[model samples]
Target: MADSTGTQARDTRLYFPHLQTLDETVRFHAERQPQTAAVRCEGRSLSYAQLHQESNRIAHALRAAGLKPGARVAYLGKESEHYYEILFGCAKSETVLVPINWRLTAPEVSHILQDSGSELLFLEESFAPVLEQLGSAAPRTVVRLGATEAEPDSFPAWKATQPDTDPAVRVTPDTPLAQLYTSGTTGLPKGVVLAHRSCFAIRDALAGENLDWIDWREGDVALIGIPGFHVGGLWWATQNFNAGVTVVSMPAFAAGEAVRLIRELGITTACVVPAMLRLLLGEPGVTPEDFTTLRKIVYGGSPISESLLEESLAMFGCEFAQIYGLTETGNTAVCLPPADHVPGGPRMKAAGHPYPGIGAKVIDDKGQELPIGEVGEVCLRTPARMVEYWGLPDKTAETLVDGWIHTGDAGYIDADGYVFISDRIKDAIIVAGENVYPAEIENVLERHPGVAEAVIVGRPDERWGETVHAFVVAAPGDRPSPRDLHRFLAQRIASFKLPAKYEFIDHVPRNPSGKILRRELRDRFWGDSERKVN
Candidate 1:
């Protein structure tokens, strides 16, 4: 097997030699750590060996159903033990696996299934109604896990009655192994295609590295609550699982349940958003006394304020690593190391330095490279990059060029190599010739006692062309008036940066991954028949 072309026709060897499919990645680890507990779901724990056998059973079931190689199968369900089986089973059969966020609306799921051409749908027993709305797309191959079947025409149950041989399957380096839909903030969801080589390259890339430098340990068990639909959740777990570490899964994140998991599992390494981290820390019994075993908390998604960060540092008494990357660029484009967690850090809104083998830089609107300390679009070149957008070749060519993924995020590197994310390229509000990054304004607003969470979007104004309006979620028992909220933020930032209008709400609409739905906020204002809201 040669890893080159323009030579004699031999076995095709991929760039990453370690793994070619999810099945291989899981099996290699399972064989090595057969006795290690791989999953703990609702009162059930499956060892690596048990997970292997169960996944094999799922593979056998798929084969029996006449699902061939390269078929797209989506797991439209929440995270659990069965989710892993469906993912690995499809991988073993050389099928593309798509995990949909259970929190999404029916239309969102329908779009994903139709866009991905998913032939099989593996759903949680509870989510059967979700699929019920999207009628016979892909023949409606429903996968019910451990529940009574729905009536006529519903799909088959994922039973483990039969045994399946761990068959040797082939996956080319370029073969698409999975499809994940993006946030669809700009428009419709883009199917981000990831190949076997790309996926394994990342897993293999970090395998030999010593996370010990970051205080990671084999003895550490992580409490993971991020939805598996997102790349962060799925791949972060993959990294730990392969490292022979245990991960306690939360089907869906709840502050109370996560606190319980941390207490019960002695969780040490957890990858969570700041919101979840805050929620966990704010809970009744989350003192340093309660978290005796916790060691490292890695967070990203969005920025955390200095106050929250410091409070969390004191509360957890562990290393906090902030990772920055997008679904398009794979993982760890930039990592804010624990050393940056100083008393007065400059990596304030920064995402941090690029990971090994990942090249990053800031570029101006004209596509020319910018000097350090200049705010521009952040871009990266990495082996872990996505091959292409599933069906948008034009958009693919625009975003990915000369092997660099032009991260739509607007930020720049400092003189010291730290990357600060200012705002989204499309999200930066241009008001009366002044550029206002929502993140900066939102950051200040979120620190206010009354503001629980904040999102900033530009609304059209006849005079300024656009003005900043805030959609804020107030803290419990606090509802400051729009005027008061504006006054609260006026001293923190410039007058123009102050949100002109405020809409108080119970909770800000956010994605399952905890990213504020800024697009939705914009749509609320932009979708109305009238324009230029005063």
Candidate 2:
């Protein structure tokens, strides 16, 4: 399909054939498309030249603040144009950017900062309370995005002191660019180190397939509602910025605000989780008219319910694509393209095909490849796969084997090469596209004084693809109210990780090896559902 500019959107390879690195992409646009809009948020916009200059200043500022190459710097804020500046700046300075989830509690935030060994921190003013709660535990050098008198060190003021000249630091495509944290089976978060190559590996792999749904075109206005902390949010913004398209960033997603932004900005394309789509549809004033300019809506992070997909296909009247990957896989290694989005069709149940350069295989318990239609561990080999789990060589060795990532997901590849995900080999629940590990929640619940045992599981929810459900055993004669547990967990973890539903049980089921029978607990909630996951 030709884009608004009458350019063949499918001919992307002809346009962006040599964007090898993030800094190179920025420089390419600044030199050739200086006047084009690069990013926009909350009514503010930055052109390519302006973005390049500001990031140059940020790179200098970070360097002056004692950050050297390979140093980690953390940012705790919602989506914004400033965040992209920091991202690019980090690339220019050869520093690694670590974005922490704003939804996490003070302790949770502190843990990531400490774990990453980040010396500098950038945050939004709204998170001052979390910093205050952290006290001396917070990072020593903090710069507030929109600082007030009370908050101090404003990001604008800091950038003004630095030179607006490029650092021109030497960095390779393999240089680590970002560290994204994901919950491990042990309940602690592990930092996934992404390299410059990780960001563009998938794009390079898709050079031949000029899928109009993903191709960038002049005059394309993209709406970004996802948080910048997750790969989905960070990569979406970078992808658009790299293409020199205008990106409208939503600080945080709200059903009403998202609808308003889509209408007001005339967003031509958007990438969202199924829950975001449902929320937009549920908004009272939203209609087909609101999304008229929206040409494509890409979703992933969790399987979309058939009902929601059908309703969305009818309501939005836009092309749909489903991306499948993990933070450790850069972003997308497999995609269910628009052509396969037929409702109720057999392909609808599949996760779509792997990208051209991605290799996917299902393996049995003995580590042998499984035949078609037999479910087993899903393994993926792609250039986009992460270099390693930061500072954990042992864990990295286990995950990355012979250049192939052993994705802890169970699925089967059909005769047509379509991949169908049956369940998670790892006990991770995806709530609105965010991965929530059961062990993380169980650790929090079992800590409560009135709780003797706890097991967390996922249950189907219409809005969020799946919400956390907890089955707990109270102490001898003590009853732990849901309200109390909620309050306790609120101070310990992110709100999204909290249980939406709770049940009191007399005993917690476990195998002889003392491993929690998550499948058994999940079965109680999932009933006879063929797929164990939502």
Candidate 3:
């Protein structure tokens, strides 16, 4: 480990010489600690040796199946040991992995599959209907997971026949590893192309900074509750695995099951969004004892209420930290250290300071830097920054200016260097930690025959951080109730994206430019809530 002083560690690459690519790190650990447990999911465990061999097999199989380097392989399923195997296999063969959220509707799933140009798709049998609906839109090759298939085309049969020898493909740190799709401000989701360097750049910097809380130790056990599709889950699991630690992953976020797994696995550290913590607290059998083994808990991606934070602190009795970043930035660029997590510290509400080697600035509309304490767009420049939005040069150019990523979040830096997120400049609704765009839902709602027009906004909810609320303009001589619209949209979008409440208005609020006045609708619902975001 590096000393608290950052200089020596930075020069030495934090004693990790294999920082050239993720594949290098995996090989490094496989050689040194082959028998050590690398990952665990459900009742199965994979040692470092097993992980390396499985990934190698998968890579060879992918090559045999005619998947060339730089080809995109997508996965549509929940978290599992197979996730890491395929992810590392992609890195080994220089293929990009695209993990789609299983909650998406068929059209949404199809859009991502087609947009990413996925050559091969790995998914659970439960989601086979989604592909059946796609027909021509589906990927060329589909591998079914979960159950054993005896046919020659089955995932198990194919991987079992492949060679266990490493592919030994040449790749640089800049090689693309994954394409994570964040909901687009427009209707379609935009793929954020993340390179192999993203997994290590920030982590290596932190290692040099001697930030022990964020660092993984020899016997550390990490619990990943977040889905693998998002940067949070994949990044967290990779960080721990890179450190040669064990990662216990849950299939999906179920409050009761999460608590049980944490207790059963003796998870020392965890990464979760605030909503998960709140939900975990509500589970019937969850008690303080269940979290006794946890040493640290990192929460972010949405605003955490002080009341809930305090409740969690009292119940868990563990170190708490906050991470702030986006899918485009790999993961955390700004992190609130555990020291500033005091009960009523001024910095508690802040997003914390930027990590070492990370540059953050608040800029005005003209791209001019704003003064400290003045709200503006939060911009970040870091080595861990994404390569681009996959295949969207214009959108990539729009977000990445020079070397900085324009975070489209309204925030300001304090004199103490903490970033305070005030509002979102983009029209996005974060419902229970899931990014929901109004345009996407509006597009679905407007397609209904009885809906002449629609505008979607977020409203505060006690259970979910925020819930989608819709204001609809019914078609002449035909009116649709909220229940009717809900049923209509049931097959079109994720259930979570469905509006929690609806207001039938004659005319939807629009500016002279004919754009929906989302702020006006948001203000009507938010009222005097100090935090514009729920």
Q: Each candidate's TM vs. the true structure? A: 0.76, 0.96, 0.96
- List model 2 lDDT by residue over 1-534, tens digit each: 545433346643223656767898888789877988888888888999998999999999988888889999899988788899999999999999999998998988878888899888998988889988877667779999987544349988888878877777788889999999988888989999999887677766665565443666668898887788888887877777667788888888998988888888889889888888888889996779888998888788788888888899999998998888888888888898888888888888888799886899999988899999999998888888898898899999988888878889999999988899989898789999889998888988899999999989899887888999999899987897999999999889999999998899889888999877878888877898888878
After superposing candidate 2 on the true structure, give the runs of residues whose Cα lies further than 4 Å from its correct spot: 1-14, 148-152
Error of 2 at 471 (Å): 1.2
| Better candidate number, 2 or 3, judged by lDDT | 3
Specify the poorest-scoring 10-residue window by lDDT in model 1: 5-14
Per-residue accuracy of model 1 over 425-522 as CA lDDT, tens digit each: 55756554344667777777888888888888987654454689888898888887888887777655557567778877677788999877777878
Worst 10 residues of 3 by lDDT: 5-14
Q: List ranges where model 3 is wrong by over 4 Å.
A: 1-17
Question: What is the per-residue lDDT of model 3 for residues 228-303, given as tens digits with 9 covering 90 to 100?
Answer: 9989998888888777788998888888877888888888899999899899889996779999989899888788
TM-score of 3: 0.96
Ordered by TM-score, highest first, the candidates read 3, 2, 1
Task: Give candidates' CA RMSD values in order.
Answer: 11.8, 2.6, 2.7
Residue 198 lDDT, candidate 2, scale 0-100: 77
C-alpha-based local distance difference test score of model 2: 0.85
